[model samples]
Target chain A: MRLPKLFKRKASGEVAKDRLKILLISDRVNCSPEMLDLIKQDIARVISRYMMIDTENMEIQISKTGGYGIGSKNPSLYANIPILDLHKSS
Target chain B: MGEVIVITSGKGGVGKTTTTANVGTGLAAAGKKVVLIDTDIGLRNLDVVMGLENRIVYNLVDVVEGGCRVKQALIRDKRYPGLYLLPSAQTRDKSAVNESQMRKLVDQLREQFDYILLDCPAGIEQGFKNAIAGADRAIVVTTPEVSAIRDADRIIGLLEANSFQQIDLCINRMRYDMVKRGDMMTVEDVVDILSVNLLGVIPDDESVVVSTNQGEPLVGNHTLAGRAYRNVCMRLMGQDVPYMDLERSLSFWTRVTGIFHKSQEGRA
Candidate 1:
């Protein structure tokens, strides 16, 4: 178990890099983790008027995509909202 | 015409002032007329680092407020013939001077000096704004730690927002031993993460602290960090100097022993 644990552990440098990547993505979009929750709630309320969404399992994040460099990357909002049912318009 | 370059980092204690002093001294040693400005008001230490703290009769506030001429406020460095320092007012706050005043001062200095290095105060506050107001370029300094890198990213974003086109990065106090041991980040790791053009990397050396304490700049010394600062100054002048081989500082026996230790750890 100890040997397996050692293999599973990551170097501290790699950990710092991964952490900064995520932190910087959020920072660039100017959206905090708390703000992300508020956005999710607002989106859920609006989407629920036409279709039911699984708010409990919804995941929303602001990340950069399509570029490898710093200034070249573009910030994009990603949402994974599961649909429960589509309401028929009367 | 002289170039106004602001050395800034969002987080404090990342060696902005030291880099400013060393680079300014190096430029002066290279026969360029250089002036170092300490923009960190109410907590000024560039004078102390440059060993001119006792000679500051006029400061940035005095120059901007019409109390003294720009030449009167400039303190000539003791060692270098062409190096000078325009220190901040320790009694005043950042609000003592505005953006336009800083711009006007830099314009006046541009007619006389070859390089005007602004040692910016930490944080994205009014002091930071005043420091970059009249600058034509920027050098964002950072360390290997996560917090410093995060703040540096923020600083780069701010510089870009302010329409700064020629922004560079300088990694300071890097511990190659820790990096070899997988405990610290490498220069490549930092450059890849920040994605900025690298200026130079200063290795962590004890001589830096000693020089800072003695109120002397390190560019005149033979230390590793001193040589790194000289390389940074050369690059600032558009010289295509290659980076110093940090790993080559170690002996061949040390490298061989390091590999053996790593293999032993792998076996464990």
Candidate 2:
């Protein structure tokens, strides 16, 4: 919901929300968004060499995975790339 | 058994020390024997905030190093019968006291007082780690500003990772005027973001500055901030106290809008 603009400037609340979104995400991953994007691009590039993949529909995320041992729950990079026609493009 | 609570914020200048002083004093005033521990080490100020700075013959480092007994280091507050201060050593850094020493100190304090309040240092460093090491619960203090809230979120995560169960939030230095104008985050907005149990909200009051400067906790005074701290103390003791009426500072336009809506509802 938008409030009536009492003053002629962007609301501080809105500005805060925008900054917090990016900051919290980066803080969790311990990396910048640009770095995350670069990682995703590199993953896509490596996988496309051996398979005809639908890059537009691919999803890649780096997050902590659950495991049941000492220091076992390491961060894992998961990529779900749809193979449109595997080994057909090469 | 006594309870130990750590008051911490990831960012500095957010009034963790003030909250500790007021709440410790308020709890003591309610007849609960309480000891306030300053674990900020080199940056210790809870003693100054409680106005017990001059009484520090021994500090946390002394107790940890076996230089003095814990009782010897505890400076009793003459104003409140049950209140005491375990001031941190201004000469020592955060490295002087480790997590185990903090736990040992808190365990000893628990054997005496009914409440042990640890005033944590800012930042997610060794001091913060040591403060939460001995805490059974935590109070995350944050102002209504973005930087404070962001840091509070990080502190909450760290507390949870350390297996802290009861982490309550206190929104400090909130300006009702700014919230009404939609220029600042409201209490609800903060609660929604942090997703924690609300302990209390301390309105921005100039009396807080005067009280702090005078080395007096503002819990027992008739001022708005004092009343807020009193309510917080009651809430800590399992009492369901209603929040103070911050709406009294609402703008005229908001009241007018409310009246128009109410009139339309009556007609319908």
Candidate 3:
């Protein structure tokens, strides 16, 4: 007997975009959720290190992306870093 | 001393037993004295998967409970010279053994085998805890699905909490055709989400079902996914083999373009 086709339907042009943001709590220092937050925060912190502060209205966010491996050119990370300084002494 | 590696995942049916059987057979075929310990008590499938269920005279719990020595409980795999299996007790509860008890059991076996692969049970409960207690390292298995990844992430968190020195990931049952069609997540997505060293990726194949039904691992025979598992064993042995292309088929456009270019060259 012939096996029925597996995933033989017509392919579409649209692709799913996975939007994943893992929150970083101080105590949760490991796992995927923590790692995504670390990647985002490090980018924001790197930018903040070289610039002046406007902490009151500062916000940063990163959605998990998978088009490229973490070690290579991650244009998304570079694009998503918050441009404003996010540190304050208050 | 022989090393102990636990094949564990936080979710069920994510290919933990499959990994254990294949890795055990692969290592054994490579001339290492390998023993697979099925620690999934009350849900024993490793013996069945390995086709050693009918030959079981003693089990893991029996050794732990002092009913028999570890040697007496180990069943040798006939296909490979050095492969053995310490089957789990299907009738026992996970709570019957504690973490330290498992640690002692694996430690004793460590002196006798080149690699001891533990087939951990599902869930982050007593079975999971007991399975990891005796192992030196861990191999976390996950499917490309979100639920399996969520569970694997939790398992990785637990292992890190316990200070496991080495932990790796294996994304199994991956269907690259689905991934190309955007129907399933790619291995890259899984690696990015987990952020762990990838041991390897096993393509989803009907051969796996056939082999499991036959009570034999794909790695013990010739199959595409079986070769992937064989590569994984090599990687585990510190060989730097490149990962194979997970895509089952190039998009039709890609093949069409290749043919189009070739015919143009022929015209020239």
Candidate 4:
């Protein structure tokens, strides 16, 4: 019997690319992955106060846009928060 | 006026010195008046690499301190009529020279040479600061490994922060066979991650070791790395030279052996 695909190893090059993508993003923004998590939680808390949101599935990250040229890259925050319902304002 | 360029890498042992020596020699061989300034200070090695260690009478610190004339400290390469070296001080540390002093020295040399290549020391410290202080352009060198790539990214970010408009990347010691086997990152992968203009890619060749041991830059010879360095020099001169085709340059016997190895792996 063959082992499951999940047991197969990833190509080292692909692993390097994946690692660098996240590492570079963090390095560029001067924000650690743990710091990003805190920011994500804060965002979720603020959104939850106004609406019912899927905190478990919310995603937040800092990414770069614009040309890859030196001094041209612009870092911006991206968030994906799922909302199930809206709360009535008091 | 000559253009001042610094060859730097955040991490050590990534071929910054080798690239500086070869590129400087290559440019000189092309009939351009070039001066290579070793700014590593205290950990000086460029002099030995260029085989001019014994000729060093006065060093960078001496010139900066007014202990010697800038012209007096420069050691000319006998092999190239237009090539010279400003050796770093072996007895002093990075703090021996500061930013304005470096700017002044480079400014002085600018009127004389056609190109000024600064071989920057490793790390982002006083030495690094002094190296980039006088540079108009920066060439960041890196290997395909994760540590080197991470450091390169950091260096690029630092260079961008310094308002450098002409930063380029040189990927060194690339192993084509490993890249073909999916064991190493390709040049495209590195370029995509670094996001800097590709200056050139040097293959991992044993001849580079031989050349360095002989105190010679590989630009004059016909080795793979030598050819790559020549292409880099051409690119620096604003010539449109295509990147070397490493795959096609492989020997037929090596290609056949590669196929046989792949078949063995398939059977497993």
Candidate 5:
């Protein structure tokens, strides 16, 4: 059994797959991908308040959502984000 | 019957040979009568990796072609009396043996051995199909790279379609320093992509290469990578062992030295 590089994602009914990953990464902090995306949006909204940033121009993409869902360990997330705080303008 | 397991990777040079060499040795060391078959055919390297190249009088082709008996082609490991190796035919093409012949050979081996380990060739060609045909289970070898994982996913889909449900993943060549620096994929990333149960993770310890080139099995030293192989062997035996922490294997000095070494290479 030779594994090729993983993730040629065919997420047909990706809800379960994506949700499982989301739970692992977030340690089940959020139950659903929709909830996680909303959290990203909410976090983005809160962070923008404390700094000079255009929330409209700010593009948010929470990607690589994955984690262990067996409940043996704490759920976690491996997400990538563009931190506007690092930007010179924001 | 002895369990038949195939170690394969979609991408070449991802340590399929090395994993077979070590894991087979680990099982053998554990007192299981193990046989490691090099199914790579024309691209055979398991013999060299296992340091039994000089002892190969008859190959898999020879057995399937009736030139020699299967027992005559099997090479017993010098280190482990219980371990044996069935080398591939370096001179023959993959066509020399088909899936049915392999199934027959494995079935025969099962009567005498406790485990049958097939070191499969790379790619999803006739060779790959032939390797998995007789496998009771398969260990998909892959590095934590985009291309390797993509091919692994393809292999998984193929295995599932073929009714080979007892499949697992062995992520090899994992570099902790790079993953710490956020430069490479984590175990989570690869497992996420493959969507299979994680069997084991072999770190990119140079000890493996030294052991491979020397035809000595890693189980002898119990190095990080060697221990990983042993742990995987346990898992294959139906134990639910959690994976070792790749981070804990390295101390602060080792990490610092590695970073400095990388910086030196960058400067050079």
Candidate 6:
């Protein structure tokens, strides 16, 4: 039973962690992964009307942030939209 | 004054009531005046779990609604001298009692008992709100499942938002054999995800069912789960008790191999 590190077995820790991270985000936003994808699509479409954005590289997540000057915190939606180009006509 | 602690789990059937009953009985066994309040209301089961269902003459709603005195509603445990039970009314619903009334009742009981353990109902609803309203501390119970952990996280957030201090976690129904086999979530995995002070891990034991049927908390019982609950009670009493060595049966080589394999899989 004494095996070396070269032949390690897969434990459930990583699986639990990965699932919890994504699930906690979705739970905070009250949205499923598919719903989040749709929301991201909608955001990208709406923003692309004014600017050329890279939807593939866009990142949307829920993060826990501290309330301003207070000892409390809240979950806020953070969206990182990469702008490839802006509309010159406007 | 006694400390009021609420045992809560957003997901149902995660051993909240069991924890409340056991912890209360454990504290009482330690000679501390303890009262377990079942706040589940219409869905009350703490009475049955504690085997004090037949002795329930007055309930929590009766005290809150001015139908009876708090002492009249309190049921003393037959086994534990200092233990008591404030059963919830099965006829009434959660809406029957509000936050302020619960606070007042708990405040009165605080002057009398050494610990008031509130057995919270499942879900983040009115019942949950009322259960936590009177608590000075919180014990969020959850199983190793993803859904249960997520709910526990949400409940922790709610507790923090409501200014609850000293929040702790208890992983219930933990299978030590599965953990040793690396199939189930380990205690470290849960602690890392939830990021709360670990209370205790109750190993899955068959004696729990029998003890529940017998209407007694597992303090004096020689079951694995009973010992775990006793450890939790000691820790709650501010003792520097080390966690039970659940991996005593596992060989060193097996653990090392399991970790090595887990890390290899992670990289892959």
In order, candidate lDDTs are: 0.89, 0.84, 0.77, 0.89, 0.77, 0.84
Write candidate 5's Cα lDDT for A1-90 as tens digits: 112322443322233335434333332232565776686678667776665455555544333334532222333444344455644463
**Ranking of all predicted structures according to TM-score, beginning with the best and ending with the worst:** 4, 1, 2, 6, 3, 5
Model 4 lDDT per residue over B185-226, tens place? 989999988889999999998988998898988784556787
- Highest-DockQ candidate: 4
lDDT of 4 at A22: 86
Off by over 4 Å in 5: A1-90, B252-268
Top candidate when judged by lDDT against the true structure? 4
Report model 6's TM-score to 2 decimal places: 0.80
Q: How many angstroms is residue B13 displaced in model 3 relative to the true structure, after the best TM-score fit?
A: 0.5
Model 6 C-alpha lDDT per residue in residues A1-90, reported as the tens digit of each score? 635632575566567777787777667657777877887999998998899988889999875564331133356778999988887256
Docking class of 5: incorrect
lDDT tens readout by residue for model 1, A37-73: 8999999899888887798999888876654434575
Order the numbered candidates by DockQ, best leading: 4, 1, 6, 2, 3, 5
Query: In candidate 5, residue B40 scores what lDDT?
Result: 90
Q: Which stretches of candidate 1 lie over 4 Å from their true place?
A: A1-8, A34-60, A66-73, A78-90, B252-268
lDDT of 2 by residue, A1-90 (tens): 354554566878767766765566566567876787788888889887887889889877665465422233245777888999877653
Give the per-residue lDDT digits (tens) of candidate 3, residues B1-268. Answer: 9999999999999999999999888888778999999998888999989998899998888999999998899998868878999999989889878899999998998898999999999999999999999888999999987668778877887887787878899999888777765667777767776777899998887889999999987783445577788889999998999987556334676446546654654311
> Per-residue CA lDDT of candidate 6, range B1-268, in tens?
9999999999999999999988988888888999999999899999988999999999999999899998898998888779899999999898999999999999999999899999999999999999999899999999988889999989988887898868899999898787766668889888876777898999887879988898877763445677788889999999988887777624676457546654654311
Candidate 5 or 3, higher DockQ? 3
What is every candidate's C-alpha DockQ against the true complex, given to 2 decimals? 0.48, 0.28, 0.09, 0.76, 0.03, 0.32
